[model samples]
Target: MSTPTRKPLDRHALWSLLSEKSDFWTEVNVVGVTGSTNADLAEAARHGAEEGRVLIAEEQSSGRGRLDRRWTSPARAGLTMSFLLRPTAPRETWGTLSLLTAVALEETLKAVCGLSAKLKWPNDVLLDGRKVCGILAQAEGGAVVMGAGLNVSLTEDELPVPEATSLLLAGATALDREVIAAEFLAHVGAVYQSWNERGPASVIERWQRNSATLGRHVAVSFPNGRSLSGRAVGIDADGRLQVAPDGAGAVETVAAGDVVHLRPRD
Candidate 1:
Protein backbone atom coordinates (compact mmCIF):
# COMPACT_ATOMS: atom_id res chain seq x y z
CA MET A 1 0.00 0.00 0.00
CA SER A 2 1.15 3.53 -0.75
CA THR A 3 1.85 5.95 2.09
CA PRO A 4 -0.36 8.98 2.68
CA THR A 5 1.01 12.25 1.40
CA ARG A 6 -0.89 14.55 3.77
CA LYS A 7 1.38 15.86 6.52
CA PRO A 8 0.64 17.14 10.01
CA LEU A 9 -1.20 20.46 9.88
CA ASP A 10 0.74 23.56 10.88
CA ARG A 11 -0.88 25.28 13.87
CA HIS A 12 0.30 28.74 12.87
CA ALA A 13 -1.34 28.53 9.45
CA LEU A 14 -4.52 27.10 10.96
CA TRP A 15 -4.72 29.78 13.69
CA SER A 16 -4.18 32.51 11.14
CA LEU A 17 -6.93 31.15 8.97
CA LEU A 18 -9.31 30.87 11.94
CA SER A 19 -8.52 34.36 13.11
CA GLU A 20 -9.35 35.81 9.71
CA LYS A 21 -12.40 33.68 8.92
CA SER A 22 -14.02 32.33 12.07
CA ASP A 23 -16.10 34.38 14.47
CA PHE A 24 -16.16 32.15 17.55
CA TRP A 25 -12.89 30.26 17.75
CA THR A 26 -10.57 31.65 20.44
CA GLU A 27 -7.78 29.09 20.32
CA VAL A 28 -6.71 26.25 18.04
CA ASN A 29 -4.30 23.47 19.01
CA VAL A 30 -3.05 20.75 16.72
CA VAL A 31 -1.26 17.71 18.07
CA GLY A 32 0.52 15.13 15.94
CA VAL A 33 -1.07 12.32 17.95
CA THR A 34 -3.48 11.91 20.84
CA GLY A 35 -5.74 9.36 22.42
CA SER A 36 -8.85 11.31 21.57
CA THR A 37 -9.50 14.98 20.86
CA ASN A 38 -12.73 14.76 22.84
CA ALA A 39 -10.85 13.49 25.88
CA ASP A 40 -8.35 16.33 25.56
CA LEU A 41 -11.05 18.99 25.37
CA ALA A 42 -13.10 17.42 28.16
CA GLU A 43 -10.08 17.65 30.43
CA ALA A 44 -9.51 21.25 29.36
CA ALA A 45 -13.15 22.12 29.97
CA ARG A 46 -12.84 20.65 33.45
CA HIS A 47 -9.83 22.93 33.97
CA GLY A 48 -11.87 26.05 33.06
CA ALA A 49 -10.98 26.35 29.38
CA GLU A 50 -13.49 28.73 27.84
CA GLU A 51 -15.56 28.22 24.77
CA GLY A 52 -14.09 28.18 21.25
CA ARG A 53 -11.06 26.11 22.16
CA VAL A 54 -10.31 23.47 19.52
CA LEU A 55 -8.11 20.38 19.60
CA ILE A 56 -7.21 18.55 16.41
CA ALA A 57 -5.10 15.44 16.21
CA GLU A 58 -3.38 13.99 13.18
CA GLU A 59 -3.95 10.49 14.51
CA GLN A 60 -5.95 9.06 17.40
CA SER A 61 -4.59 5.94 19.02
CA SER A 62 -7.60 5.52 21.31
CA GLY A 63 -10.32 7.28 19.38
CA ARG A 64 -13.92 6.39 20.12
CA GLY A 65 -17.27 6.75 18.45
CA ARG A 66 -20.82 6.70 19.79
CA LEU A 67 -21.48 3.85 22.23
CA ASP A 68 -17.73 3.62 22.85
CA ARG A 69 -16.87 1.96 19.57
CA ARG A 70 -13.28 2.28 18.41
CA TRP A 71 -12.48 4.90 15.80
CA THR A 72 -9.06 4.76 14.16
CA SER A 73 -7.33 6.11 11.08
CA PRO A 74 -3.86 6.39 9.67
CA ALA A 75 -1.68 9.38 10.51
CA ARG A 76 -2.80 12.51 8.66
CA ALA A 77 -5.25 10.43 6.64
CA GLY A 78 -8.34 11.76 8.38
CA LEU A 79 -9.66 14.92 9.98
CA THR A 80 -9.99 14.52 13.75
CA MET A 81 -11.16 17.54 15.68
CA SER A 82 -12.89 18.45 18.92
CA PHE A 83 -14.36 21.76 20.02
CA LEU A 84 -15.19 22.95 23.54
CA LEU A 85 -18.17 25.18 24.09
CA ARG A 86 -19.92 26.80 27.01
CA PRO A 87 -23.48 27.26 25.82
CA THR A 88 -26.24 29.46 27.22
CA ALA A 89 -28.92 27.07 26.06
CA PRO A 90 -30.40 24.45 28.35
CA ARG A 91 -28.65 21.12 28.65
CA GLU A 92 -31.38 19.30 26.72
CA THR A 93 -30.54 21.36 23.64
CA TRP A 94 -26.99 20.07 23.67
CA GLY A 95 -28.03 16.94 21.79
CA THR A 96 -28.47 19.10 18.73
CA LEU A 97 -24.83 20.11 18.71
CA SER A 98 -23.76 16.92 16.99
CA LEU A 99 -26.55 17.41 14.48
CA LEU A 100 -25.35 20.98 14.00
CA THR A 101 -21.82 19.84 13.27
CA ALA A 102 -23.04 17.19 10.85
CA VAL A 103 -24.93 19.83 8.92
CA ALA A 104 -21.98 22.19 9.06
CA LEU A 105 -19.64 19.52 7.70
CA GLU A 106 -22.09 18.63 4.95
CA GLU A 107 -22.24 22.25 3.88
CA THR A 108 -18.45 22.56 4.04
CA LEU A 109 -17.94 19.56 1.83
CA LYS A 110 -20.52 20.73 -0.64
CA ALA A 111 -19.34 24.33 -0.87
CA VAL A 112 -15.62 23.71 -0.41
CA CYS A 113 -14.91 20.34 -2.01
CA GLY A 114 -18.02 19.98 -4.17
CA LEU A 115 -18.78 16.62 -2.63
CA SER A 116 -22.39 15.66 -2.01
CA ALA A 117 -22.76 14.52 1.60
CA LYS A 118 -25.83 13.74 3.66
CA LEU A 119 -26.52 13.21 7.34
CA LYS A 120 -27.64 9.86 8.72
CA TRP A 121 -29.52 11.24 11.68
CA PRO A 122 -28.15 11.64 15.21
CA ASN A 123 -24.43 11.61 14.16
CA ASP A 124 -23.08 10.07 10.98
CA VAL A 125 -22.36 11.72 7.64
CA LEU A 126 -22.82 9.54 4.63
CA LEU A 127 -21.56 9.65 1.06
CA ASP A 128 -23.45 7.39 -1.30
CA GLY A 129 -24.92 5.63 1.74
CA ARG A 130 -21.53 4.84 3.27
CA LYS A 131 -20.27 6.66 6.35
CA VAL A 132 -17.65 9.33 5.72
CA CYS A 133 -17.76 10.94 9.12
CA GLY A 134 -18.83 10.33 12.73
CA ILE A 135 -19.72 12.80 15.48
CA LEU A 136 -19.84 12.43 19.25
CA ALA A 137 -20.94 15.07 21.74
CA GLN A 138 -20.62 15.02 25.52
CA ALA A 139 -22.18 17.60 27.79
CA GLU A 140 -21.41 18.35 31.41
CA GLY A 141 -22.73 21.20 33.49
CA GLY A 142 -22.55 24.25 31.17
CA ALA A 143 -19.84 22.87 28.92
CA VAL A 144 -20.38 20.68 25.91
CA VAL A 145 -17.57 19.00 23.99
CA MET A 146 -17.94 17.60 20.46
CA GLY A 147 -15.54 15.46 18.51
CA ALA A 148 -15.76 14.74 14.79
CA GLY A 149 -13.69 12.19 12.90
CA LEU A 150 -13.72 12.45 9.13
CA ASN A 151 -12.17 9.98 6.76
CA VAL A 152 -10.25 11.97 4.19
CA SER A 153 -7.69 9.94 2.24
CA LEU A 154 -7.94 6.46 3.65
CA THR A 155 -7.82 3.67 1.12
CA GLU A 156 -10.27 0.78 0.96
CA ASP A 157 -8.07 -1.48 3.08
CA GLU A 158 -7.41 1.20 5.63
CA LEU A 159 -11.09 1.77 6.35
CA PRO A 160 -11.90 0.46 9.82
CA VAL A 161 -15.24 -0.90 8.65
CA PRO A 162 -16.75 -2.13 5.42
CA GLU A 163 -19.46 0.54 5.42
CA ALA A 164 -17.02 3.43 5.61
CA THR A 165 -15.71 5.84 2.95
CA SER A 166 -13.36 8.76 2.58
CA LEU A 167 -13.63 12.00 0.65
CA LEU A 168 -11.02 10.70 -1.80
CA LEU A 169 -12.96 7.52 -2.45
CA ALA A 170 -16.14 9.59 -2.72
CA GLY A 171 -14.46 11.66 -5.46
CA ALA A 172 -14.01 14.95 -3.70
CA THR A 173 -12.53 17.61 -6.00
CA ALA A 174 -10.24 19.05 -3.36
CA LEU A 175 -8.28 17.60 -0.43
CA ASP A 176 -6.89 20.67 1.35
CA ARG A 177 -7.18 19.97 5.07
CA GLU A 178 -6.74 23.61 5.99
CA VAL A 179 -9.57 24.73 3.74
CA ILE A 180 -11.86 21.97 4.99
CA ALA A 181 -11.09 22.64 8.64
CA ALA A 182 -11.46 26.40 8.32
CA GLU A 183 -14.81 26.22 6.61
CA PHE A 184 -16.13 23.61 9.03
CA LEU A 185 -15.22 25.69 12.08
CA ALA A 186 -16.65 28.83 10.55
CA HIS A 187 -19.91 27.17 9.67
CA VAL A 188 -20.15 25.42 13.01
CA GLY A 189 -19.72 28.73 14.79
CA ALA A 190 -22.53 30.23 12.75
CA VAL A 191 -24.74 27.26 13.43
CA TYR A 192 -24.03 27.41 17.13
CA GLN A 193 -25.03 31.02 17.27
CA SER A 194 -28.19 30.39 15.31
CA TRP A 195 -29.01 27.45 17.51
CA ASN A 196 -28.57 29.56 20.61
CA GLU A 197 -30.79 32.34 19.28
CA ARG A 198 -33.47 30.38 17.45
CA GLY A 199 -33.16 27.05 19.21
CA PRO A 200 -33.15 23.63 17.48
CA ALA A 201 -35.96 24.47 15.05
CA SER A 202 -33.67 26.17 12.54
CA VAL A 203 -30.87 23.69 13.12
CA ILE A 204 -33.24 20.76 12.90
CA GLU A 205 -34.70 22.14 9.70
CA ARG A 206 -31.33 22.19 8.06
CA TRP A 207 -30.38 18.80 9.46
CA GLN A 208 -33.62 17.31 8.14
CA ARG A 209 -33.16 18.95 4.76
CA ASN A 210 -29.87 17.08 4.36
CA SER A 211 -30.86 13.91 6.21
CA ALA A 212 -31.01 10.40 4.77
CA THR A 213 -32.49 8.81 7.89
CA LEU A 214 -35.87 10.39 8.26
CA GLY A 215 -38.85 8.78 6.55
CA ARG A 216 -37.14 5.40 6.60
CA HIS A 217 -37.45 2.19 8.54
CA VAL A 218 -34.78 1.95 11.18
CA ALA A 219 -33.75 -0.22 14.07
CA VAL A 220 -32.53 1.52 17.19
CA SER A 221 -30.39 -0.77 19.28
CA PHE A 222 -29.27 -0.64 22.88
CA PRO A 223 -26.27 -2.31 24.49
CA ASN A 224 -28.62 -4.37 26.60
CA GLY A 225 -29.89 -6.24 23.50
CA ARG A 226 -33.17 -4.37 23.52
CA SER A 227 -34.17 -2.72 20.24
CA LEU A 228 -36.98 -0.79 18.68
CA SER A 229 -37.95 -1.07 15.04
CA GLY A 230 -39.69 1.97 13.76
CA ARG A 231 -40.19 4.50 11.03
CA ALA A 232 -38.05 7.52 11.79
CA VAL A 233 -40.29 10.52 11.42
CA GLY A 234 -38.41 13.49 12.83
CA ILE A 235 -36.45 14.98 15.70
CA ASP A 236 -38.49 16.52 18.51
CA ALA A 237 -38.16 19.94 20.10
CA ASP A 238 -35.85 18.66 22.82
CA GLY A 239 -33.56 17.13 20.14
CA ARG A 240 -34.57 13.56 20.88
CA LEU A 241 -35.10 11.24 17.92
CA GLN A 242 -38.77 10.71 17.07
CA VAL A 243 -39.71 7.36 15.69
CA ALA A 244 -43.13 5.75 15.21
CA PRO A 245 -42.83 2.26 16.59
CA ASP A 246 -43.04 -0.47 13.92
CA GLY A 247 -46.65 -1.53 13.84
CA ALA A 248 -48.96 1.41 14.49
CA GLY A 249 -48.21 3.50 17.52
CA ALA A 250 -47.37 6.92 18.85
CA VAL A 251 -44.09 8.64 17.96
CA GLU A 252 -41.55 7.48 20.51
CA THR A 253 -38.85 9.88 21.51
CA VAL A 254 -35.51 8.18 21.79
CA ALA A 255 -32.93 9.82 24.01
CA ALA A 256 -30.03 7.66 22.86
CA GLY A 257 -29.61 4.59 20.73
CA ASP A 258 -27.60 3.23 17.83
CA VAL A 259 -29.72 3.77 14.70
CA VAL A 260 -29.49 1.46 11.76
CA HIS A 261 -31.39 2.07 8.53
CA LEU A 262 -33.10 -1.10 7.43
CA ARG A 263 -33.40 -2.21 3.84
CA PRO A 264 -36.75 -1.87 2.21
CA ARG A 265 -38.50 -5.19 2.05
CA ASP A 266 -39.05 -6.73 -1.34
Candidate 2:
Protein backbone atom coordinates (compact mmCIF):
# COMPACT_ATOMS: atom_id res chain seq x y z
CA MET A 1 0.00 0.00 0.00
CA SER A 2 1.04 3.58 -0.53
CA THR A 3 2.12 5.54 2.53
CA PRO A 4 -0.55 7.77 4.05
CA THR A 5 -0.10 11.51 3.61
CA ARG A 6 -2.23 13.63 5.91
CA LYS A 7 -1.97 16.07 8.80
CA PRO A 8 -2.41 15.21 12.44
CA LEU A 9 -5.96 15.50 13.75
CA ASP A 10 -7.07 17.12 16.97
CA ARG A 11 -9.12 15.32 19.64
CA HIS A 12 -12.45 16.92 18.77
CA ALA A 13 -11.89 16.23 15.10
CA LEU A 14 -11.08 12.61 15.91
CA TRP A 15 -14.38 12.13 17.71
CA SER A 16 -16.21 13.76 14.85
CA LEU A 17 -14.54 11.49 12.33
CA LEU A 18 -15.37 8.36 14.32
CA SER A 19 -18.96 9.49 14.73
CA GLU A 20 -19.53 9.01 11.04
CA LYS A 21 -18.64 5.30 11.20
CA SER A 22 -21.14 2.58 11.94
CA ASP A 23 -21.43 0.91 15.37
CA PHE A 24 -19.13 3.53 16.87
CA TRP A 25 -21.92 5.29 18.72
CA THR A 26 -22.20 2.64 21.39
CA GLU A 27 -20.73 3.19 24.84
CA VAL A 28 -17.55 4.88 23.64
CA ASN A 29 -15.97 6.99 26.35
CA VAL A 30 -13.18 9.44 25.55
CA VAL A 31 -11.25 10.82 28.49
CA GLY A 32 -8.65 13.50 28.88
CA VAL A 33 -6.73 11.88 31.69
CA THR A 34 -3.46 12.51 33.47
CA GLY A 35 -2.87 8.81 34.12
CA SER A 36 -3.51 5.47 32.46
CA THR A 37 -6.40 4.39 30.27
CA ASN A 38 -5.67 0.70 30.93
CA ALA A 39 -5.88 1.23 34.67
CA ASP A 40 -9.10 3.19 34.26
CA LEU A 41 -10.57 0.50 32.02
CA ALA A 42 -9.60 -2.19 34.49
CA GLU A 43 -11.36 -0.28 37.23
CA ALA A 44 -14.38 0.17 35.00
CA ALA A 45 -14.45 -3.54 34.24
CA ARG A 46 -14.21 -4.34 37.91
CA HIS A 47 -17.23 -2.09 38.42
CA GLY A 48 -19.14 -4.10 35.81
CA ALA A 49 -18.61 -2.11 32.66
CA GLU A 50 -20.56 -3.59 29.76
CA GLU A 51 -18.84 -5.56 27.07
CA GLY A 52 -17.76 -3.65 23.95
CA ARG A 53 -17.28 -0.51 25.99
CA VAL A 54 -14.22 1.48 25.00
CA LEU A 55 -12.07 3.90 27.00
CA ILE A 56 -9.75 6.28 25.18
CA ALA A 57 -7.39 8.71 26.80
CA GLU A 58 -5.56 11.68 25.33
CA GLU A 59 -2.58 11.52 27.64
CA GLN A 60 -1.35 8.90 30.06
CA SER A 61 0.93 9.52 33.00
CA SER A 62 1.46 5.88 33.95
CA GLY A 63 0.81 3.92 30.79
CA ARG A 64 1.98 0.30 30.89
CA GLY A 65 2.91 -2.58 28.62
CA ARG A 66 3.27 -6.34 28.87
CA LEU A 67 5.26 -7.53 31.91
CA ASP A 68 4.57 -4.14 33.57
CA ARG A 69 7.01 -2.23 31.41
CA ARG A 70 6.44 1.53 31.33
CA TRP A 71 4.82 2.94 28.22
CA THR A 72 5.40 6.55 27.30
CA SER A 73 2.70 9.01 26.38
CA PRO A 74 3.24 12.39 24.84
CA ALA A 75 0.21 14.64 24.69
CA ARG A 76 -1.87 13.71 21.64
CA ALA A 77 0.94 12.12 19.69
CA GLY A 78 -0.50 8.59 19.74
CA LEU A 79 -3.70 6.61 20.14
CA THR A 80 -4.28 5.08 23.56
CA MET A 81 -7.37 3.00 24.21
CA SER A 82 -8.72 -0.11 25.89
CA PHE A 83 -11.56 -2.36 24.71
CA LEU A 84 -13.69 -4.63 26.92
CA LEU A 85 -14.65 -8.06 25.62
CA ARG A 86 -16.63 -10.84 27.26
CA PRO A 87 -16.01 -14.01 25.33
CA THR A 88 -17.69 -17.30 26.13
CA ALA A 89 -14.65 -19.47 25.66
CA PRO A 90 -12.52 -21.01 28.37
CA ARG A 91 -9.85 -18.78 29.80
CA GLU A 92 -7.11 -21.15 28.66
CA THR A 93 -7.53 -19.74 25.16
CA TRP A 94 -6.79 -16.16 26.12
CA GLY A 95 -3.25 -16.31 24.79
CA THR A 96 -4.63 -16.39 21.26
CA LEU A 97 -6.58 -13.21 21.79
CA SER A 98 -3.49 -11.01 21.53
CA LEU A 99 -2.54 -12.50 18.20
CA LEU A 100 -6.08 -12.00 16.96
CA THR A 101 -5.90 -8.38 18.07
CA ALA A 102 -2.63 -7.92 16.22
CA VAL A 103 -4.24 -9.10 12.98
CA ALA A 104 -7.20 -6.83 13.52
CA LEU A 105 -4.87 -3.91 14.06
CA GLU A 106 -2.89 -4.73 10.93
CA GLU A 107 -6.09 -4.76 8.93
CA THR A 108 -7.21 -1.47 10.42
CA LEU A 109 -3.93 0.23 9.58
CA LYS A 110 -4.00 -1.03 6.01
CA ALA A 111 -7.67 -0.25 5.44
CA VAL A 112 -7.99 3.12 7.13
CA CYS A 113 -4.55 4.71 6.99
CA GLY A 114 -3.33 3.25 3.69
CA LEU A 115 -0.17 2.06 5.38
CA SER A 116 0.98 -1.52 5.66
CA ALA A 117 1.88 -2.73 9.14
CA LYS A 118 3.24 -6.08 10.35
CA LEU A 119 2.83 -7.97 13.58
CA LYS A 120 5.99 -8.46 15.65
CA TRP A 121 5.24 -11.69 17.44
CA PRO A 122 2.90 -11.55 20.46
CA ASN A 123 1.50 -8.01 19.98
CA ASP A 124 3.73 -5.20 18.77
CA VAL A 125 3.08 -3.59 15.39
CA LEU A 126 6.02 -2.68 13.21
CA LEU A 127 6.19 -0.16 10.40
CA ASP A 128 9.17 -0.65 8.13
CA GLY A 129 10.73 -2.77 10.88
CA ARG A 130 10.37 -0.14 13.64
CA LYS A 131 7.93 -0.44 16.52
CA VAL A 132 4.83 1.65 15.98
CA CYS A 133 2.19 0.04 18.20
CA GLY A 134 1.89 -2.21 21.23
CA ILE A 135 -0.98 -4.37 22.46
CA LEU A 136 -1.58 -5.52 26.01
CA ALA A 137 -4.33 -8.06 26.68
CA GLN A 138 -5.44 -8.87 30.20
CA ALA A 139 -8.16 -11.10 31.57
CA GLU A 140 -10.17 -10.04 34.59
CA GLY A 141 -13.11 -12.02 35.91
CA GLY A 142 -15.14 -13.04 32.88
CA ALA A 143 -14.00 -10.18 30.67
CA VAL A 144 -10.81 -9.51 28.72
CA VAL A 145 -9.49 -6.01 28.20
CA MET A 146 -7.16 -5.31 25.31
CA GLY A 147 -5.23 -2.09 25.48
CA ALA A 148 -3.37 -0.57 22.53
CA GLY A 149 -1.04 2.36 21.90
CA LEU A 150 -0.23 3.40 18.36
CA ASN A 151 2.27 6.16 17.68
CA VAL A 152 0.45 8.28 15.19
CA SER A 153 2.24 11.60 14.92
CA LEU A 154 5.10 11.33 17.38
CA THR A 155 8.43 12.62 16.18
CA GLU A 156 11.83 11.12 17.03
CA ASP A 157 12.19 13.57 19.91
CA GLU A 158 8.90 12.41 21.35
CA LEU A 159 9.68 8.70 21.23
CA PRO A 160 10.22 7.21 24.67
CA VAL A 161 12.65 4.63 23.29
CA PRO A 162 15.13 4.57 20.48
CA GLU A 163 13.48 1.47 19.01
CA ALA A 164 10.11 3.16 18.66
CA THR A 165 8.55 5.02 15.70
CA SER A 166 5.35 6.68 14.54
CA LEU A 167 3.15 6.73 11.49
CA LEU A 168 4.44 10.16 10.55
CA LEU A 169 8.02 8.93 10.64
CA ALA A 170 6.99 5.93 8.52
CA GLY A 171 5.66 8.25 5.80
CA ALA A 172 2.07 8.45 6.94
CA THR A 173 0.57 11.91 7.28
CA ALA A 174 -2.96 13.23 7.79
CA LEU A 175 -3.94 9.92 9.40
CA ASP A 176 -6.66 10.93 11.84
CA ARG A 177 -6.67 9.05 15.14
CA GLU A 178 -10.45 8.92 15.34
CA VAL A 179 -10.75 7.54 11.86
CA ILE A 180 -8.19 4.93 12.74
CA ALA A 181 -9.95 4.15 16.01
CA ALA A 182 -13.33 3.75 14.38
CA GLU A 183 -11.92 1.49 11.73
CA PHE A 184 -10.03 -0.51 14.36
CA LEU A 185 -13.16 -1.00 16.50
CA ALA A 186 -15.19 -2.15 13.55
CA HIS A 187 -12.59 -4.65 12.40
CA VAL A 188 -11.69 -5.84 15.88
CA GLY A 189 -15.32 -6.39 16.77
CA ALA A 190 -15.78 -8.52 13.69
CA VAL A 191 -12.62 -10.48 14.36
CA TYR A 192 -13.54 -11.01 17.98
CA GLN A 193 -16.97 -12.29 17.03
CA SER A 194 -15.45 -14.69 14.58
CA TRP A 195 -13.05 -15.90 17.22
CA ASN A 196 -15.87 -16.44 19.65
CA GLU A 197 -17.61 -18.68 17.15
CA ARG A 198 -14.80 -20.44 15.29
CA GLY A 199 -12.00 -20.37 17.84
CA PRO A 200 -8.46 -19.01 17.36
CA ALA A 201 -7.16 -21.16 14.53
CA SER A 202 -8.56 -18.88 11.88
CA VAL A 203 -7.27 -15.79 13.62
CA ILE A 204 -3.84 -17.38 13.94
CA GLU A 205 -3.86 -18.03 10.23
CA ARG A 206 -4.56 -14.38 9.59
CA TRP A 207 -1.85 -13.39 12.04
CA GLN A 208 0.73 -15.55 10.33
CA ARG A 209 0.02 -13.77 7.07
CA ASN A 210 0.93 -10.37 8.54
CA SER A 211 3.68 -11.63 10.84
CA ALA A 212 7.25 -10.45 10.30
CA THR A 213 8.88 -12.79 12.78
CA LEU A 214 8.33 -16.14 11.13
CA GLY A 215 11.40 -17.64 9.42
CA ARG A 216 13.70 -15.05 11.00
CA HIS A 217 16.57 -15.72 13.37
CA VAL A 218 15.50 -14.54 16.82
CA ALA A 219 16.65 -14.23 20.40
CA VAL A 220 14.01 -15.25 22.93
CA SER A 221 14.44 -14.14 26.53
CA PHE A 222 12.42 -15.63 29.34
CA PRO A 223 11.40 -14.00 32.61
CA ASN A 224 13.46 -16.60 34.46
CA GLY A 225 16.67 -15.14 32.96
CA ARG A 226 17.23 -17.87 30.39
CA SER A 227 17.61 -16.96 26.72
CA LEU A 228 17.78 -18.94 23.50
CA SER A 229 18.74 -18.03 20.00
CA GLY A 230 17.00 -19.83 17.16
CA ARG A 231 15.03 -19.45 13.97
CA ALA A 232 11.32 -18.69 14.30
CA VAL A 233 9.51 -21.54 12.62
CA GLY A 234 5.93 -20.37 13.15
CA ILE A 235 3.25 -19.99 15.80
CA ASP A 236 1.63 -23.12 17.10
CA ALA A 237 -2.13 -23.60 17.55
CA ASP A 238 -2.02 -21.90 20.92
CA GLY A 239 -0.22 -18.82 19.58
CA ARG A 240 3.09 -19.85 21.12
CA LEU A 241 6.26 -19.13 19.22
CA GLN A 242 7.75 -22.22 17.60
CA VAL A 243 11.51 -22.04 17.31
CA ALA A 244 14.22 -24.45 16.26
CA PRO A 245 17.96 -24.44 16.73
CA ASP A 246 20.34 -25.18 13.90
CA GLY A 247 20.46 -28.90 13.04
CA ALA A 248 17.85 -29.66 15.71
CA GLY A 249 14.88 -31.77 14.76
CA ALA A 250 12.70 -30.73 17.71
CA VAL A 251 11.02 -27.31 17.73
CA GLU A 252 10.56 -25.56 21.07
CA THR A 253 7.29 -23.92 22.03
CA VAL A 254 7.81 -20.58 23.74
CA ALA A 255 4.73 -19.48 25.63
CA ALA A 256 6.06 -16.10 26.70
CA GLY A 257 9.22 -14.17 25.99
CA ASP A 258 10.83 -11.04 24.62
CA VAL A 259 11.50 -11.99 21.01
CA VAL A 260 14.12 -10.04 19.14
CA HIS A 261 14.39 -10.96 15.48
CA LEU A 262 18.09 -11.09 14.75
CA ARG A 263 20.12 -10.35 11.67
CA PRO A 264 21.34 -13.47 9.91
CA ARG A 265 24.88 -14.48 10.80
CA ASP A 266 27.14 -13.67 7.89
| lDDT for each residue of candidate 2 in 73-113, tens digit (9 for 90 to 100) | 67677888898888887677788989987898898888777
Per-residue C-alpha lDDT of model 1 across residues 1-266, encoded as one tens digit per residue: 46459877988887888778777999899999999999989988988999999999999999999998999999999899999989888777888888899999999999988988989978999999999999999885579999999999998999999999999888899888988898899999998988988888888888899889999999999778889998999888776788999787888888888999998881
Task: Identify the runs in model 2 with alpha carbons over 4 angstroms from their true place.
Answer: 1-25, 247-249
Q: Rate the local accuracy (lDDT) of all candidates.
A: 0.90, 0.82
Lowest summed lDDT over 10 consecutive residues: which window, candidate 2? 1-10
* Candidate 1 CA-lDDT value: 0.90
Per-prediction tally of clashes: 0, 3
Error of 2 at 136 (Å): 0.4
TM-scores, all candidates, are 0.96, 0.90
TM-score of predicted structure 2: 0.90
